[model samples]
Target: MPRSIRYFVAPAAMALSMCATAVVAQSFSSSTFEIPKPERQTFVPAGTSCGSIVLTQSTSQSITAANSVSCNAGGLHSDNSYFRSFPLAADINVCEVQFGIETATGASGTQPVTVNLYSGTGAFPGTFPGSYTQIGTASLNVPDQAATIFPATVSGLATAGSNLVVEVFTPDGQTAGNSFFIGSNASGESAPSYLQAADCGVTSPATTGSIGFPGMNIVMNVVGNPGGPSLSVGSAQATLVDQCASNPGQANGVIEPGETVTVQVPISAAGGSFTGVVATLGIPAPAGITYVNSTSNIGSLADGNSATATFTVTADAGATCVTGFSLPINVTSNEGATASGSVASQIGESG
Candidate 1:
């Protein structure tokens, strides 16, 4: 089955340089921002032609720009800006790039300039993706813009596993040169299906506002009984959640004909305060399965206990924080055995 992919934010500029690779190396002479804006010339001029969006595992491939410029220690400028689309293979999740300045012409002065990189689901943006949209940026000063080298990486960006779009733009009104593929390279990542997370529910008195920091309570009563089978992971981890901070996100426990256990996941309000809390079930899942009550549907845990995944908001004193939230229940076997939906009270506030 085709799997869903997840992305992680890459490290800032310096961290990437420490571990540069020759295989996935750069091609442009310089990736610096240097072209001076003419009194009226647009950086990415009106009729400029953008490049193609292709899916490939190759880390580097030669590409041509619609228009080209000169070179400096920094590298090249884009009269012809380019965009490339690549599919992140199922076995990997991260992509990296180093910029070079080349094909230069005119001007030789250093200025603090910015470059923007954007990631989205489709073709390149006709206009630039918002300044707020770039996943990463770099700044440099050089004899000429193409003389400076800009290095950047894209990490933890989720992909449906195919046709993910990546584009580079000049932020200082200068245009970006065509980035050539250096090699078919990527950081190996575990398959998304194997990732899992575990957490116990929180049981607490509401104080006022948001409680339940990332880690506060013990995740009790794992859905499968004790001594159940263990989970496996490739590169990523299996993430679980304690949905109900003070209340359960799913039914409390299951009482069945064959195996029955009382599993409890408890939650507590932070030091006598009440605030809205967000307890996630897990990062979104791949296609083969989904999590319910923090357990795989194949079977119930030893104790028959379940967990919760939720997002709740709390108001200030007397602001009417959420009174309760609902739990979603599912039964893999008999349809009639399922429990009706349930709601529990919000931890009461003290202050």
Candidate 2:
């Protein structure tokens, strides 16, 4: 059996109180706590794409006239095709992609941009055959004469230990001398940028260049789950009983000295499945509270499943002076994931 581990931090302690029966006035309150979710990983090489030399001409015009003529042909410019290669630390489902681009003042236009993710083979500018998959594309509107980020949504799976290639295609060729450029970082750190121009074309052996200086401003958003199961606490309830004869008719939130409080917490599991769940209560001895039953077994939970645990607390006859108190509850899974939550209430003393 594969071993898994999960860690959860329960919410802050809830307030509960036990006082004389004479103190019948009290109020109940509820608040929610946030559970940590799996974090998204981002890849950003050291560089910016503003003010870098033009690499490939995305427009359809020939490479020589690409800079002079606006290849407004409305498709990938044979002159400018760009790609970046990087490695994945773990298996991830890619969710988003962003690119930095520059446009001349008053050169606003909308075009559909295509992005592809490929499994790499060989070297830096790996051989991207027809086997590559077209993840998704976005229709972006460029702002004239300004530096802006173009964001797109793409979905694909990249396995760990594989070199991933991200390719970007520009829409339509632009008019001659009309300036539009892809951003790049000057530092060729991390992934090397490759260019396939009309002159060199994608078919010719690709040449490595730092065109979009700092390197191309490309970002990849990856969705992945942290190891093990994830756990969280839901709504909680407790039974209140006044053991002290002095506080006979106290409300749910109020208890007299020698009263007993029973708390029930709801637990849930997400992200993965696990077995042997247990819940325990942690009360400070100095708080004048005793745990009648400190632990409960929850058994097993499949992913997206839920269960509840109950605990009993008794107030010491001599427990006094404190108007309110709190206790910590911890829930653990045999697989190693743990979650915590608390219950609390206010107390008033009666004559």
Candidate 3:
């Protein structure tokens, strides 16, 4: 899992008639923590249609943690095509697609990136050649800019689920391994980025993770309309992590004093952009439960858009344990107007 930006509040002393003696609030994270890089990748096939994922990564995979300079894709001297699957809920006519560039490698000039999109039935890799049918293709030259978006033209109507498969490559226009690299971040994309090429050792659909880079993702994003994209809940299944770490007694699958509960809310904003995105638990914690970190900053949403707001809830000694708890959360963004939605999570049974 990835780390979230946290805000910690100090413990304050409140006299419970000056008699209770000791009791305090606390703070915690979903886990240790790393920059949350969210991305969307489906599957990549052989050939150089769109820009291939960089082969010989400039930055070592060993150092590919969040904020690592070495992009999950992009290599020092490898030529390969990169691909990812996007499953959006709206019906869209993709007019263009953007391939984020991390580094131009050694592209003094003449680094051409050809991108393509395929409409497919069934799931990717699982369906492969039989599922994906070419939609359209576009190309662009790699710019000198260090980090930015390079776009390609692709036309198609994407539906829900396994809608579209995107591809990028460095055809014959530029040196195979000496062109540019695709940009990626630790924002937390659900799909996997796929690559294809001989120099990269992958002749077919293989994840950057499979080849060594575990969490590498090519920021292959979409720019389409017709059915203008919107942001909504993708997955809101909130649960507890390391119950023992927060739980005071036996991990009896029930909410007990000192137990830490994690509420992870994942949202996908394919073509929807939201600002000042924030998430908070809608329902107040039952008696004895302290919402250590109740709200999380989702920040902004854009082309390569997705975010997971993780909140921490704890059960104090005074908590009232009952049946499993159902937590409702609200995700709101101010886009000129306030747009918000509520989601419920079955965190745990109150003991």
Candidate 4:
């Protein structure tokens, strides 16, 4: 039997709570990947036109712990089409879908991603009902795992439980098409960021990036004159990797030189409890970025005022249940900087 690994992430303590003991919050993680070997194989009825979408199971085997299932909703690379779908349940508290998709490998740019869940039956495949709730929509510029969540109030969702289909669509409707599969039971581990952006003056353009050192997508947009200046960006680059040292790992990216730019980088997790050695690099402006919490700030550079974002990968690995990970980000620039962002992860497991 393959070795089973569980992940756990610890929460930070409040500064004023020095006399109080730190509290560790239990977070859960989940994966949206292709199943090694999917059983109960069921294909869409003829003429249903799954389009470029497909469902796959990893290797047909038993995983001691929950893993990830892959979704090929996005079409093949040559075609550039994408796919998405949702779980068949009503009054859904929380719904998540995970999968690996095309991203910035060398420099083909990144694939733009859009995820949606609709209410549909066997007969009406083309015409979906409801508001086509947007669980996650991103312009992924890298190739990695994609995971997103949708709240219960998604428009057009079935109030009652029934056999419903979930669909993932490519934003531009590229010819290569797109593909997205479900994550393994082990995947859906945690909820990284759930705070509103307006309050912080920053927001995740899309959903939080994936786990481990997959890559990071971030947007730091600011408007009008608050206590600070405004800023925006078109695009940028970021990356993450595992060092296997006493620290968890590290990652960084380049922020294009401009009043505003969009940045994308890789993020990762090694499926076990490992201290993460993290850092932020190539920050064009220090005055524009601020750390929400001083405790989470690990390192910084003074010369160019360029700072490195740092945090720990809470100890969740080597446990009995799933673990979760997340890195919150905030950006500030002179007015006119509309920052949009997204993130992804490269999940690693132990045997």
Candidate 5:
């Protein structure tokens, strides 16, 4: 994955620089918004050419703006614009936008493109509240054989369930023969349909409305603290394999005197709240089973994260046979929360 983080603090503020960097690193996350191909067809202006706009599943998860319409003049003001809305599940600091451009055939020239973020008023392709900011810009050259990813750093705060309109603008002043399309994917689908302006100029005017395309995939990377950390542990299992046996295949939930068994468990964190988690296996000494360094340290975890821990147990050579022995597992976090579970281990003579 191509991961990138952007700090919103200004460079002149030296005192808060380190703190900002740390918070930004911890808050890094991403989301991809996508939509399926539309049942109807739509058209959009690309410089001097008009292209049929439709969502295609064949080209990965991206929407295709096929530039087929051509114009006689090359220098005319032929502006093209495409817009998509992204809904946030929780409050987040918008950081980056990643996209790609594909040009099959067209004049060889540089196409000036700009990406902007706007707060939607309401409904699909809702009204822009005039509170919009330009996040980034790029100059795309013609004859791009492969899909090229363009990543831009954007700084803004959005409320939960809020719609953030992402607009891509291809202005005039470039070669009219320069015809191409923007690439998108259907990895993550969400609300608020994709919109575009066919013959509209550099900016997406208020009059521009929603198109036939409902879902278009445009990936957005954001950073935020969802909530306090949560933790969980998967089921624990024990493995016993005779070292001297020819096959030495592993046995489940069974062990013998003087033999060793390994227990494995998986731990996870939800809401990214807890840090410095540790797992320990608690076995009574009187049971004749020794805990040989059976502790796993899981440094830290963010929300929706996970880790694994393993424990080793050894049975005494002269120990009495035990059936269905219960071994306790204790997982503690620095945040003052502890989770407990148990696994069964059996020690008996095998024919």
Candidate 6:
């Protein structure tokens, strides 16, 4: 979550010593026009290997010779972080994340790297290392062509104008013995990705295109449900139970005819947090029934959390076999999440 800041007097006289975790060395970035050519390599399909379409910038199978950019630190340095951004298709919870890297070999003596998920709020790689309050994080050990599926679940993250930003932090160590390259391709997702290495004169996140590699898209992917929020999260549900004062012991999930009853529908919340939740009648009561009270307060619910909602109604005494009745409910929260559903009930007059 942190690193040191150093002062560089000039760009030419780029030799500077960094404080804290940053290594002491001259800053470096490369941008030579290399012909992008593929030479028979195992293809890494961007398909949903984790049961859902994984998100990624590069869709090409093999890394082109000219596209295979350096791992994390473009040059010899300690503590370098890279960022990539993408817009999620509405309510989809991220199930997995994977970023590619060439893996440091020989003298590099690399440390484990972390994949972090941050709330998307401005144009990506613009000025944000793109990390404010991280939503989820996972660490992976590097291999020669490390493309580890980061094991983490991210939810409730709506695209706040900006796309979801991913931070890949590499602790290349201060020694700068040797450096590895983060996996990259010529796919060029969005502005060639961004770098946040302060020692490299990149105090703020600047596009790699600005530094040097103008044709690079940090090889990273996100996988998850594209249809909606996870079944286990970000959803609301309810079950109706009837409570009657006159019929003691007869109060069992059904609405009895001619009885004034309180229909208690417990509203449940999951995924993101919810507050000031309330339920209101979405449709008029069916024929032969009258609504005494239609609004019910659900209160507050923390992430993966709570419920309590109810309404009162009465049935006509002469109504027999009151079927085809539906109670449509509209549940809303302070955050503006509106979920609507209805429960159908059939009433039988007591014999």
Q: Using lDDT as the measure, which candidate wins?
A: 6
Q: Which digits, one per residue and each the tens of the lDDT, describe model 6 over residues 1-351?
A: 453322223245344344687534546533122222333233464333222556666655344433433322334445678887776556444545656653344253434667787765555655354344566565554433332222322333434344677777777554535454565666546435777666556666667777656665666766655443221211112344565577667677566667777665545443466777888876667787888889988777665333556778777776666465777777788887655555567676444
Angstrom error of the Cα, residue 43, model 6: value is 3.2
Candidate 1 whole-model C-alpha lDDT, 0 to 1 = 0.24
TM-score, cand. 4 vs. native? 0.27
- lDDT of the structure predicted as candidate 3: 0.51
Model 1: how far residue 83 lies from native, Å: 1.9
Q: Show where candidate 6 strays beyond 4 Å.
A: 1-24, 29-51, 59-61, 65-76, 106-110, 126-132, 144-156, 159-162, 175-178, 227-351
Better of 2 and 3 by TM-score: 3
Tell me how many residue pairs clash in candidate 2: 50
lDDT of 4: 0.25
lDDT of 3 by residue, 67-102 (tens): 212211223334457788776555665645666665
The sequence of per-residue lDDT tens digits that candidate 1 reaches over residues 1-351 is 563322111123211111343212111221223233331121111110010111222222222221122111123322222233333443122222333332223344433333333445443233224321443333333233322223332222323443333333332223332222111112221111010001111111111111211111110000100121111111011122224445453323321112112222222111112222222223442122233334423332222122232322222233233333232322222212221112232322223
Q: For residue 109, give model 2's deviation from the true position in Å.
A: 3.3
Q: Candidate 1: which stretches are off by over 4 Å?
A: 1-81, 91-95, 104-108, 111-115, 123-134, 142-150, 153-156, 171-351
User: How are the candidates ranked when ordered by lDDT, highest leading?
Assistant: 6, 3, 2, 5, 4, 1
lDDT of each: 0.24, 0.45, 0.51, 0.25, 0.45, 0.55
lDDT of 5 by residue, 255-336 (tens): 6777776767666554345777998877564377877757989878665445677777787788778644666777899997
Q: C-alpha displacement of 169 in model 2, angstroms?
A: 0.6
lDDT of 4 by residue, 41-67 (tens): 222111111011112222221221123
Task: Give candidate 3 misplaced runs (Cα > 4 Å).
Answer: 1-78, 105-108, 160-162, 172-177, 227-351
Error of 3 at 322 (Å): 69
Better of 1 and 3 by lDDT: 3
How far residue 44's Cα lies from its native spot in candidate 2, in Å, is 8.2
State the lDDT at 222 in candidate 5: 26
Poorest 10 consecutive residues by lDDT, candidate 5:
45-54
